[model samples]
Target: MTPERFAECLASLRWTAIDLTSALQCQLSWIEAMEGGQAEIPEDLARWLESLAKCHEAAGIPSHYRGVAQF
Candidate 1:
């Protein structure tokens, strides 16, 4: 994903790594790697993040708060 877009997602999520990891059902290290752009975001992780964002939106979060995803 474009770095800017990734940053946007992070911002929307309020930098809550623990919460995001729980939402994505992944380890915090995984989320940290992806957010820090240290590890290449695999397709699965990308999909996971997308699904998590959708879930958040469905739970009454604003759609506009969601960000574009990339692998």
Candidate 2:
């Protein structure tokens, strides 16, 4: 996925960079690189994020707020 799409997924999940770093057990710089287009978001990782967003959607996490997703 593109860096912009990665960032959008993060926003949809209401996750900050720190939250992603903790969850992925990776360095903040690595995530920053991904978000900044210095690194590519892996295909598996991209698919996982998409699935997570789907889960959140299916569970009505964002249903109350329309396009806005809440953690």
Candidate 3:
């Protein structure tokens, strides 16, 4: 995903770079770089985001509510 979209996904999940990094066991700089467009988003990170979205859905969080603008 594009950096902007990744950032939006994080916002939708109520997460920051710090949160993602901690959850994914990656460096904060890596998450920041990806979100800032300084580096390409890793495949693992993309998959993690997708999985997290699915989990949220399974938890009954509506898509509309999880959108960036909703919070």
TM-score for each prediction? 0.50, 0.77, 0.68
lDDT assessment of candidate 2: 0.86
- Evaluation by lDDT, superior candidate among 2 and 3: 2
- lDDT by residue (1-71, candidate 1, tens digit) is 64455556656556577877787688989777767878777777566556755665567655774685855
| Local distance difference test values of all predictions, in order | 0.67, 0.86, 0.81
The whole-model C-alpha lDDT of candidate 1 against the native structure comes to 0.67
Which candidate do you rate higher for lDDT, 1 or 2? 2
TM-score of 2: 0.77
lDDT, model 3: 0.81
**How many backbone clashes does every candidate have?**
0, 0, 0
Q: Write the per-residue lDDT of candidate 2 for residues 1-71, one digit (tens) a residue.
A: 89998888888788988999999999999999999999989999899888886676667553456768668
Off by over 4 Å in 1: 13-15, 44-71
lDDT of 3 by residue, 5-71 (tens): 7977787688988988888898898888998899998788788787876676568655675547743
After superposition, candidate 2 runs with Cα above 4 Å error: 62-71
Using TM-score as the yardstick, the better of models 2 and 3 is 2
Ranking, TM-score, top scorer first:
2, 3, 1
Tell me the lDDT of model 1 at 61: 53
